[model samples]
Target: MLKRRLLTAALLIILIVLEILYLNSTTLAVIFAIVVALSAWEWAGLSGYLARAQRIGYVAIVLFLLILVYSAHSFWPTAITVFLLSAAVLWWLIAAYWVLRYQQQCDLLPNSSPLRAWLGGVVLIPSWLAVYQLHQQYGEYWVLFLFVLIWGADTGAYAAGRLWGRHKLASHVSPGKTWEGFAGALLVGALFAGGAAYFWLDESEALYQIGFVLLSLATVVVSVLGDLLESLFKRKAGVKDSGQILPGHGGMLDRIDSLTSAAPFFLAGLLLMGSLS
Candidate 1:
């Protein structure tokens, strides 16, 4: 498993580098969109949607991707913010809906068995759109930053949890995670991001510097939450891993779970910091 994981990691790093240096933002967007769509397909099954229903949901994802692919000329950030805010709103509603319909929703997570088809597609589309937009709107570092922040944090957490974890972080949800792991991950992520900011961003603007640092911290939080969110979803869905597309890693979802949540938040930080201009 470790060997398979390392091989996959090596390939992924090469692909990411190529995407950053060679692929145009549009091409990168298309690739990322495909990945998210597949994850969403898995998400449908995880949510209790039927096979036929998931097929329909899959169609919606295709259509959604088409819209994103063709609408390339639109004010990119505006489109992204719109999608992100929409997703955020939906996320809130999902949480509220769960709270309101606790009795029906708790045990009825609409697994591949609970498929709500279109609704599941709705939940995932905006995130994919937002992430693709971030890649296009920002620089290679911007895109890579999201992925690396997650990697740094996840790696730190795992290593720290194994080495220094004295107390369990979330014993109920993910027993393996520990507070030490969480803290270590956050520290590494923050340091990596701060260092990146010092070396990468326009040093002339104090605003950019401040914004970048805060953005880095925000990225770390979102990345952590992204993993936790997926874990939460899988826990509720009564599954392990989103899908088995990879040997050691679970799926594309497992690989990009942090980005799913982090991308939008990172963009939001850009907006708040007025870095979008």
Candidate 2:
């Protein structure tokens, strides 16, 4: 299982890197839209819309919203973009509360609840836009940097969890995760961000580098919230995996859950820091 997971992950990384490096922004947007659609499909199942028609309908609604938001972004770039991203940040903050407060006896959303579907939109759309904005405005390397930082954090968490994990971080949500692992993730993410800033920025820009590293660390922390949120939903839904799309990975949702939350928060940080004009 581990080998299959690693192989699948490696292939995915290669494909994503090629897409970011070679594809134009418009083409990448289309591709990302397709990915979001697939994730929405899985999210539909988690949202309790198990029927084929219901899942398709859910995907349609999500795609329609995606187009609507895309059009709004085209017409009013700065205003709509900031609005959606800020909303996403707020939603994640709420989601953090939900995950942390989750209990086995907590009320779960009924199957086919429109609220659950709306929650799907809230979770997926801003992330898609944030990724597109980052790639289009900042360039592929910044996007790559975001991916690398998350990947590093994930790997560090896994390694440290295996080595020294004792205290559960959130056992009700995900019993496998540990506070030691969370620390490892932050440490690795910060180190990578600091190293990148050192090479990319000059000595006179020390403050900027410090801010960048701090932002990266915060992004890593939020990424864990993303993973926990999905785990909470999956547990409530009584499923071990989201879907069987990948060989070892559960589904597109499982693979990109962390990214879904990290992207918007990271981009918002960059914007606030005046990294983009």
Candidate 3:
């Protein structure tokens, strides 16, 4: 299982790198939209929309919103984009609270609830927009940097959890995670961010370098929240894996859950630092 998982991860990394290196921003947007649509389909199932039609309807709604946002965003001002990204960051903060306070209580938001549907939108659309905006405005390198931080953090967490993990980070939400793993993730992510800032960012200022590392670490922390939020949903839904789409990875949703939360927060950080202007 570990071998398969590693192989799958390697292949995904290669493909994603190629996409970032070769594809135009518009093409990347389309690809990201497709991914979001797939994730929404899986989320629909987790939300108790089991029928084929129900899932398709959910995907349709998500796609429509994506289109609407993409179209309307072109005419909107920069502040609007920042506002939307900020809203996504706020949503994830609330999601962090939900993950922390989650208990096996009665399903407050039942399956097929409109609230769940809206939650899916909130969880997905801003991520797509943030990623697309980053790739289009900043360049593919920034997107690649974001991916490196997330992937590095995940790899660090997994390795550390397996080797030295003792205390559970959130046993109720995800049994495999540990505080040791979380620390490992922060360490790895910060190292990568510092190295990248020194070598690739072309910035000589110490303050900027420090800020970049801190931002990367913050993104890594929130990526954990993203994973926990999904685990919370899966626990409530009583499913082991989100779906069996990848050989070792559970599904598209499972693969991208961290990205879903990280993208917006990363973008917000970039904006706050006046990196994008």
Candidate 4:
């Protein structure tokens, strides 16, 4: 399992590096659409709609959204901000529902059936918009920063969880996640973000380090939220893994959840930095 994962990840990393660094933005956008679309498909399964008809509906909605997002002006930043806000609110509402239902003896997601058909619109559209935003508004370094932070956070959380995890971060949602694991994730993610900022960015100053740490911390929190949000859906859906895409990992949705949360986190950080500086 480890061997297959490493091999697959290594090959995919090579392709990603080549795409972001060497390929044209349009080409990268096409690649991003295909990948994110597949991720949306996986999210459908995680959301507990396994029928082909249901999957098709979700996919159709997602595709329509991608078209609309692509056609919009200032799509990148605008779309990402919109996406981040929606995701944040959705998670909050879900959390609130969980709490409220605890007293009422009702299903928190009594009719989440429609969500499977519509959530792809929420999840995938912004993703494509975020890809566009990164490609058009930021340099390759920032784009790569967005991707690496998510990957780093997930890897850190998993490794640390396995090694030194005890206290559950959210036992109801995801039992495997621990506060220790969360701390490890923050450390690894911040370290990776700091390195990316300092090295890729041609600046050498204390302020840069400060920015890196703050941004990295923000990225970590958002990434964790993304993971937890997905876990909420999975628990509601009553599934172990999202799907069987990766051997050790779960699915495309599982692989990309961190990215979904962190893209806007870093983008917002970028905006704040731009304003302050």
For 179-208, candidate 3 gives per-residue lDDT tens digits of: 999999998998899899889876557777
User: Which of 2 and 3 is ahead in lDDT?
Assistant: 2
Q: How close is candidate 3 to the true structure, as a TM-score?
A: 0.94
Judging by TM-score against the true structure, name the best candidate: 2
Name the 10 consecutive residues with the lowest summed lDDT in model 4. 99-108
Q: Which tens-of-lDDT digit does each residue in 76-106 have in candidate 4?
A: 6465466555674465446445634532545
**TM-score-best of 1 and 2:** 2
Judge candidate 4 at residue 158 and give its lDDT: 82
Q: Which stretches of model 3 miss by more than 4 angstroms?
A: 77-79, 103-112, 275-277
TM-score of each: 0.82, 0.95, 0.94, 0.83
- The numbered model that scores best in lDDT is 2
Note the Cα lDDT for every prediction shown. Answer: 0.68, 0.90, 0.88, 0.70
**Candidate order by decreasing TM-score:** 2, 3, 4, 1
Name the runs in model 2 displaced over 4 angstroms. Answer: 103-112, 275-277
lDDT per residue for candidate 2 within 120-163, as digits (tens), equals 99999999999899999999999989999999999999999999
